[model samples]
Target chain A: DAGVTQSPTHLIKTRGQQVTLRCSPKSGHDTVSWYQQALGQGPQFIFQYYEEEERQRGNFPDRFSGHQFPNYSSELNVNALLLGDSALYLCASSLGQGVNTEAFFGQGTRLTVV
Target chain B: AQSVAQPEDQVNVAEGNPLTVKCTYSVSGNPYLFWYVQYPNRGLQFLLKYITGDNLVKGSYGFEAEFNKSQTSFHLKKPSALVSDSALYFCAVRDMWKDTGRRALTFGSGTRLQVQP
Candidate 1:
């Protein structure tokens, strides 16, 4: 089975520009979550989408939002991007809603804000 | 608030030597702990988790973690280090806030492991 897949392995955008990163969760998974990983840092939770609705969110601002489709794919949209937004955008998928379920991750989209 | 701390930013070990990446956590109630590894330019891979059971939780790639409730720590360990094992390691805690329906994994700052051949 193919693992979680993300598009645009790398991208560069200017400040205030909007960007959308896409992700396809692993087959048989139902939940998708987004995270931000700065250079030399661990991935930080952004939000999670389950059943086409945002179920949980982290400490991120309103500029960060996401959507989940019926096929369990997801898109992470960042509006009014800032310099600090330049980081690796990661998408992880899990099979269920429980806290103990293991999550499979995508390679991530590297967002570079100039 | 729930949080995870990986005290070591980097760890170096010779091949065939045992390695340990330290992690400590703070959370109310029983904490669900996890360890993940990320290689260069790749995403995080689940290593192991501690829900309920033995203190030592064995996981993928011959890795294991020790969950200490009293110490509030879950440390990852490998019996023998391999060069291919060099990567970034993260410790996470599953949390749920009282006033919010937010239940997700919170990660540590990460620890980079360098295995020397």
Candidate 2:
């Protein structure tokens, strides 16, 4: 089966620009979550989407938002990007709820804000 | 709020020797713990999880984790390390905040394991 897939493996944008990153969950999965991993740091939770609605969000500002479609794919949007927004954007998919399910991750989109 | 901590920034082990990466967690309810490995330029790969049952959970690549409830710690262990095992390791937990419904996994800062041949 195909694993979680993300598009635009790498991108460079200027500060204050807006960017959107896309992700397709693994087959048979329903939930999509986004994370940001800066250099020399672990991935930070951004938000999670389920049932076409945002179920949870992390400490990020309003500039970070996301959407989940009926097809179970997702898009993460960042507006008014800052220099600190440069990081690897990761998408992970899980089949079900709670702590029992395992999440499969994508290779991630490397976002570079100049 | 639920959170996890990986105290070590890096762990160095020799091939054929045992290795251990430490982790501690905090949560209001029962904590569901997990371990993952990440190679350079790759995503985090699931290794194992502790939902319930035994205190010791075994996973891929002969890796296992010991969950200590009293200590609130879950430490990843391996009997024999290989050079290929050298990578970044992360510990995470499924967290649910009162504000965020089913926020999902919260990851640790990560520990770099270098297994020398």
Candidate 3:
């Protein structure tokens, strides 16, 4: 089976502009979560989407938002992007809200905000 | 809050040598610990995890992690290292406490493992 898939493997945006990254979760998975990996750092949790609604969020600002569709695909939108927003955006999919299952991740979208 | 710390910034080892990458975690309650590997420009790849039961958990490739409850640590180990094993390694944790009600994982800054051939 195909693993998690993300769109626009790489993207470039300008400051004050907006950008949207997309993800299709692995088959048989229901939950999708987004993470930001800055240079020389591990990924920081952005937020998690389940049942088409946001379940939990991290320390990100309101400018970062996400949506989960009925098909289990997800989209991450960043408004008023800053140069610091440049990082690898990763999407992970898991079976449920519990920690019993290990998450599968996509190759990630490299966002370069200029 | 749950957090993970990978003490080493980078670890260098010769090919065919055994390797160990250390990780320590913090959580109010029982912790669900995980190890993920990432290649350049790629997302995190699941390596292994410790939920309960055996302290030593085996995962993809030749990776295995030992969960030490007393130390609150999970260190990834391999009997023998390979050049292809060189990559960025991350240790993540999730607080199993129901009160936290958070499913997102807290990851460490990551440790780079370089297995020289």
Candidate 4:
């Protein structure tokens, strides 16, 4: 079974440009969450999608948004990207929104904003 | 709010010796804890989790973590270190009672482990 898969593996965009990152959750998972990991730092939660609706959101600004497809896939969109937005965008999947479920992660899309 | 802390920025150990990477967490109510390791350019790989039962949880790569409720710490340990084991280790936690915190895991800053020859 393939775990969570995200694409494109790496991306580069200029300031004020928008980019969309896609993710396909692991075959038996129903929930998808996005995280951003900057260099030398831990991942910060961006948002989560379940049942094709946004279930939860972190402290990110409105510039960041996401969507979950009916097929359990998800997409993360960042508008007017800032140089600070350059980081590894990670996608995690879990069976449900419960506390006991362990999340499986993707290799992540390394975004570089110039 | 829930949070995790890896006290050490880096841990160095000799190959073949026992290694420990410390992690402490803060959360209200029952806590669900996890440990993940990351290679150079890979995603965070789940090592183990502590949902309930067994303070000692054994996970992949012969890694085990001991959950101490009183200390609010979940430190990862390995009986013997290998050069290949050197990587970034992270500790994460979820508060079961929080309506919002349950949806995501809060991770620590990460500790780099270097197993020397």
Candidate with the greatest DockQ versus the true structure: 3
Model 2 per-residue lDDT tens digits across residues B1-117: 578999999999999999999999998888899999999888889999999999999999999999999999999999999999999999999886766456478899999999999
Contacts from the true interface found in each model, as a fraction, amount to 0.87, 0.72, 0.89, 0.87
DockQ scores of all models, one per candidate: 0.85, 0.78, 0.86, 0.86
Give the alpha carbon lDDT tens digit for every residue of A45-81 in model 3: 8999999999988889999999999999999999999
Give candidate 3's error at residue A6 in angstroms. 0.6
| Per-residue lDDT over A15-86 for candidate 4, one digit per residue giving the tens place of the 0 to 100 score | 999999999999999999999999999999998899998888888999999999999999999999999999
Residue B28 lDDT (model 1) = 82
Regarding TM-score, does 1 or 3 come out ahead? 1
Ranking by lDDT: 1, 4, 2, 3
- Higher-ranked by lDDT: 1 or 2: 1
Per-residue lDDT, model 4, residue A82, is 97
Q: In model 2, which residue pairs have backbone atoms overlapping below 3 Å? A: none
lDDT value for model 2: 0.92
User: Cα RMSDs of all predictions?
Assistant: 0.9, 1.1, 1.2, 1.2
What would the per-residue lDDT of candidate 3 be over residues B1-117, giving only the tens digit for each residue?
578999999999999999999999988877899899999878889998899999999999989999898898899999999999999999999755365566778899999999999
Q: In candidate 1, which residue pairs clash? A: none
Instruction: Name the regions of candidate 3 deviating beyond 4 angstroms.
Output: B96-100
lDDT of 1 by residue, B1-117 (tens): 789999999999999999999999999878999999998889999999999999999999999999999999999999999999999999999997667845788899999999999
**What TM-score does candidate 1 get on C-alpha atoms?**
0.98
